[model samples]
Target: MRILMATAAVTALTLAACSPAANDQKSGEPAPPNPTQTVAAPAEKPVYRFKIGALDAIALFDGQNPVPNDNKVFGVGLTPQAVAAPLTAAGQPADPIMLEIHPLLVRNGDRTMLFDAGLGAGKGQLMQSLQTAGVDPANITDVMISHGHPDHVGGLVADGAPAFPNAAIRMSEAEWASIRANPEMADLVRVITPKVQAFRPDEEVAPGVEAQDTAGHTPGHVAYLITDGQNQLLYTGDLMHHWVLSVEHPDWTVGYDDDATAGKKARLDEITALRASGAHIYAYHFPFPGLGKIQTREGRATFISEAQPAA
Candidate 1:
């Protein structure tokens, strides 16, 4: 039995080494080369890069992951066909949905705020993106989370310690509640709580940064609204998971949504409000550094990539 277990572990390790997403980085350099296999390119280099007035916003790439074949990412009511057809029409995969995580970094004056910490060191390639943009993780003053999902929070602790030792980690108070209440995540929650500074909804988390309660994806899912004196940018957390499905069908719930109904409602409401406000939405899971705007036509929402503005 011991020999069998050891052999199985070795096989798993070997498979991991040969995975397509394997690290291609050389010694002491930034991330692996920017993947040439991108579905679409942003307006500029470093994935999604933009300037919000004086605030410099860059979407740090965290690589892409495949949504499993039978995953119920689009709620219980909708079939995969309903989700894939539109993406296919728009030049995306018809199956095996690929999701890109863009952990955004906002530099405003002296304050450096990171929207979601990238999958640190191991799971994803955010650090490379950051390095490409000339950002040092140690300089991040604030680490603001949209929620506590592994992709968003996995970078919090790498090698069993706070990844950002110098930064103050911020999270919604209610989000902490849901995470801490779960028995499976209790230890992680307990370990993280000491470093966390919980903020109430609709409060100013940082200078020119306001936290909006965009619940439903999680009990305490919050979006950050960053405004310079003139320009504004809104970072929508996981309210929407996929660009095509979430925007086109805001009614669909994500597989990870704690309350599918509430998630759908929240997604629609937030998208509608942002569209009306005419603020650029920086989505966490829409696409890399998901910088896009929401367009409503005949009562249906569509994602308009920032690089490809609507006519």
Candidate 2:
């Protein structure tokens, strides 16, 4: 019996040695080669340029923050499923929602203005984007803020000093007051106090640019309107973040809103007005280069992204 077993083992080994390897499945085709080593490329810098009426506007991409996909962070009274439905239907991920941060650069004649500073210092790409757009930080004549939130004002200071030494910082009076009352932003206020040019709600901060009160995201959250007689564009700061959830379901409260009820009302009113007028919109947290027009059908507002200009 031992001799027979040894013979059988020897025969099996001989047959296996003559057979093809596992990877050589095809009868005549050569075995697939090993995968080549790969190196990941650096992220592309997102900078979009377009016209806002006659004014040249460049969308400077700051970056995106991932937020928890929970009812507590989004729709306070609704379930996570309900909040994610719109995003899912739009082929977007439902969890860990990505919130984009964009600041606008507008140039009319020799005047240059930056809408919001973005995540300041080392946290964002505003500086790189400006360089790519052939803009100098020192040459920025005006820095128009929608609100005094960290992302908006954080870039105002670097090493406890003004980041844009030559630019005059402007915001609404209410926003300035709100920032002063918040102890957490004391450092920021101290550095920017001298340059702060607080304006009335509807005051014009620059030529062809007017601030519109759109409170609720913050007490003094405002939107800017840029018009050049024949054309117009609205820069909706934080009135809405995700285009679909914010525009389609304006009643849903976001976790970041200071007053959810007021936020909802402001979003509804602003979106409705924009939709009615067919004005171009630049949403800070929509998609990159968030230049688009809102379309309402069957009581639902849909964001239609504008096509990028040809290279």
TM-scores, all candidates, are 0.80, 0.84
In model 1, the Cα lDDT at residue 163 comes to 74
Writing each residue's lDDT as its tens digit, candidate 1 over 1-311 gives: 11221233223333322333332224454321111122233323445567888778877777666775354765456677767676665556656776677888888888888888867677877777777888888898899999988889888876777777778889999998888888877656756777789999898889999999988889999998899988888888888777777777777657788888888899888877866765778878765556756755334465655542212
Clashes of each: 0, 0
- Which 10-residue span in candidate 2 carries the lowest summed lDDT? 33-42
Cα deviation of 87 in candidate 1 (Å)?
A: 2.0
Error of model 2, residue 20, in angstroms: 60
Per-residue lDDT of model 2, residues 52-91, tens digit only: 7677888887767667888876788899899898777654
Report the backbone clash tally of model 1.
Answer: 0
Query: In TM-score terms, which candidate is top?
Result: 2
